[model samples]
Target: MAKTLEFAYETPQEVKVGDDETTFTLVCKNEGLPVDLTTAKLITVKIGSRDGYLREQPISIDSLSKLPTGQFKFNFDKDTLDNFPTGSYFLEVWVADDQGTSIYPSGNPLNFIVTANIENSSGATITTIAYDDFVKELNKAASTIVKGDKGDKGDKGDKGDKGDKGDTGATGIQGPKGDKGDKGDTGTTGPQGPQGATGPTGPKADKGDKGDTGTVDNAGLISAPAFHSLQTQVNNSAVGTNLITNSNFSSGLDHWKVNPGANSDCKAVVTTDSDGDTCIHITGTGDACGLYFGPVSFNQNQVTTASVLAKGIGTIWWIGLQSRPFSNFGTISTESYSKIGSIMQADSSSDTFCVYFNPVNNVVDIYIKFAKLELGSHATDWCPNSAEILTQSDYAKIKAAIVALGGSLS
Candidate 1:
């Protein structure tokens, strides 16, 4: 294919007779081309004795340094031009492709060059071209090529009728649905849907492998991709599989063992709470027994936290989660610091994270909402469990971060 390129010369208009170390550039406007550089041959530059356009090759100057820019640098050092007389000269540059066909810009008559050589015996005085002054003059000259005096302001044309939007293109193929849903409003989430019929129990709780204590992952410096890469791995792992089954309690007690525990004598009932979310209603007489759900499996030492919203129908209640208790299941944690929620982080390796309503009461009737036992030590905003492990927010974050770091989702 033919290529179009804009080229510019960085050469000054004059050179001293013995300027042995002067360097100038021929820049490529686009980086897409190889600039005639190749393993078999180099782009060449030569000087011509006469100034008219050279239909033929000119006298070759010695080979030039192929610059990193892919352009060549023609040098006129003391040795290279020792015998040449001080006079006007023209230059031509050309390169050959693998096919041996030469490629080059149209040869133009080079701009005039004033050479200070021995032939001009008049001792010379140097004139200064301040960088700023040169730039200002250059800008002024450049502006003249593309600008002219503004014509008297033309009257505004009549407003054109709004063009109908181009017909909507046929819908493109539907993309796969986003992997996760958004982490919606974050307050104490109300109860999820009332538990549906308790499904057949899972195999009797198996004594399983204790989860491993995962290494603490840290974010890397934006400058250091290693850190980012490491954190990315960690994030990916965390986002793989969700441990909580029936997180929203939508399937009733499908993955849960909502049995009344020690001294309790009530069955776990699926019902909605004031918040209008499905929840488990545990009601029976027992000083301690309550609905228990889990034997959540995990990798050894993998930290996890269990969360549930709970409140008592009676004065005192023992609401527990992941074998831990959240003192006030419905109130802001800060209001009564003593009335706490959020279980301490623990490794799921040796012990399982369980949720139970073993409140401290004789006839305990408590409502438990959204029992979530997830992999992280902290609970993020709740999103219903499904095919996606991460929430919508999490999905967006990981995708954005990966893209920013020049990565792609698999």
Candidate 2:
């Protein structure tokens, strides 16, 4: 009875297992004898396999007690040591005094080792405990969180406090112009548009008013002075004695003559009346005399030589000569003259008479030649009531027989 008790034990030299919670501290030292232990029990504490050391269901150390210099404070719950098991934890502290059940005091046999002070492998709470000291503390915290020797950038931070003017923000209601945005895909075609700057020259207009003169119809009568007086008589001279001495006769008529009776040749007898129209009463003498008429003719010595045979009016005469100089004068009767063999003489003193007037068979084909200076005639009455008189002395004897057959009358 003198030795009331003797027990000794202290734990948690190092025991840590976590994920939720675990800690260890159990010290019970009582060399017994101060004896006021009325009920202290943690009677059994054994956890997993050191050859099957079971019994872990009773954890009631009751916050431990027994102190009066016996040193006992067993607080090992930590939620039951986090349901225990991270290695070597064999603790058995059975203590009881004062009649609940005898006590088995055993403490020094304690080998406290629940070592894992925040380190675990399969239950997971290892924060780089060793892998080469966690790669040298993660390379010294990544060399102070990366970015070394480049220092020059720091002076920009003092500009922020002007904030209270915000009430003017209500005017932003105009945001609706946004729908035109889709045309942007055409961008690669922009290098070709720079050539357009040349337009500024507009003001010089006032000069248009002068057009009105167009009306010409049927303007015809230009004989150009009768073709300039027939080209000045074919340039003065010899268009075959100026066409038989300018032809156009009828002044004292005659120059044709060769009449002996009824068919008297060279007779300048032209007649027309009762509207058949004509005129012929020459007296310009025998064969109609020289200024024109005579191809020659006769009738004189009337009653004594008994030559009284008168039947002389077979009319068909046209003699109009004028270029002068006719010396032969005898046997020149273009008999009855109906063309009298187509006279031609052109030179030995020019003679050309190609006549053919048939005032309805009042026949007159007298073409006599040999005209040197005078061969002009003109009685064109072509019957139908004839009245084409033209006579200013037969137009001055056909203009002096066209200037004596050497043309150029002007």
lDDT of each: 0.46, 0.32
Least well predicted 10-residue stretch by lDDT in candidate 2: 301-310
Root-mean-square deviation of Cα positions for candidate 1 versus the true structure, in angstroms: 45.5
How do all models score by TM-score?
0.32, 0.16
Report residue 404 deviation for candidate 2 (angstroms): 51
Report the lDDT of model 1 for residue 258: 49
Estimate, for each residue in 52-115, the C-alpha lDDT of model 1 and write its tens digit.
4423332122333435544444456554454444544555555555667353433232322335
> Candidate 2 residues 1-410, lDDT tens each?
11222212222233455433323433333321233332554355444434555545444444444334433444455555565665443445455544554332231123333445555445666533434654554454444432334434434434333323222222223346878765544323223333444444444444444345433221221222333344444443322222222223332233443233223333445543233423332222222221232232112111000000011122212222122111111111223212111111122332323221111123332223222221111111112101234668877888899989888555
Reference-based lDDT, residue 238, model 1: 63
Give the Cα error of residue 157 in candidate 1, in Å.
89
